[model samples]
Target: MEEISILLLFDVLVGLTLVWLAWQTLSSLDLFRAIVLFIAFGLLMALAWVRLNAPDVALAEATIGAGLTGALFLSALAQLSASTKRKDEENKIENS
Candidate 1:
């Protein structure tokens, strides 16, 4: 009975943490911060899957959901920044 109660507490904590991280990710204004929080959320989601005895799903969530997706988001952000910088430089040159 004590072991069961401990497990229940752990489950509730993980679930609540997942919800909070998801909310933080969504409500974040900065794109980079949002993506970082999203990655953290994915990692916690993987932990929740592991606790649920779904190792395969946990692995997928950690790799694809957090790793690959975060990398893609960061790369896209870099490209966007570069493009915006180039456009700004072009505009400045034109104005000059």
Candidate 2:
């Protein structure tokens, strides 16, 4: 019974955390921050899958959903920021 209660508690915590991460990802104003939160949510989802006895799914989610997706997001964000900076510099030169 004690072990069961512990598992139940863990489940509740993971559920609440997933909900919180989802909210953070959606409501964040900063795109980079939203991306990070999204990655975190994916990782937490992997953990949830493991707890549910789906280790194979969990592994896939961790690698594809969190790792690959997060890398893509960060790379895209970097490119965007770089382009924006270049545009700003060009505008300043034109004004000058």
Candidate 3:
């Protein structure tokens, strides 16, 4: 009985954290921060899947959902940052 209650409490906490992470990911103004939050949410989801006895889903979420997606987002961000830097350099050259 006590063990069950503790498990229930942990489940509720995990659910709440997932919800909070999702909200933060959506509402954040900084795109990079939002992406990071989204990755964290994915990890949390994987843990939730494990808790629910879905090992396959947990594996998928950890690998494709979190790992691959985070990598893609980071690469895209890098490209955008590089382009912005190039544009700034061009403007500086033109001004000089």
Cα-based TM-score, every candidate: 0.91, 0.94, 0.90
lDDT string for model 3 (1-96, tens) is 999999999999999999999999999999899999989999999999999999999999999999999999999999999999999999999999
- Best TM-score among the predictions, by candidate number: 2
lDDT score at residue 16, model 1, on the 0-100 scale: 96
Give the Cα lDDT of each candidate. Answer: 0.96, 0.98, 0.97
Clashing pairs in 3: none
What are the per-model C-alpha RMSD values against the true structure? 1.2, 0.9, 1.3
- Each candidate's clash count: 0, 0, 0
Ranking by lDDT: 2, 3, 1
Candidates ranked, most accurate by TM-score first: 2, 1, 3
Structure candidate 1, residue pairs in collision: none
Instruction: Provide the global lDDT of candidate 1 against the true structure.
Output: 0.96
- Stretches off by above 4 angstroms in model 1 are none
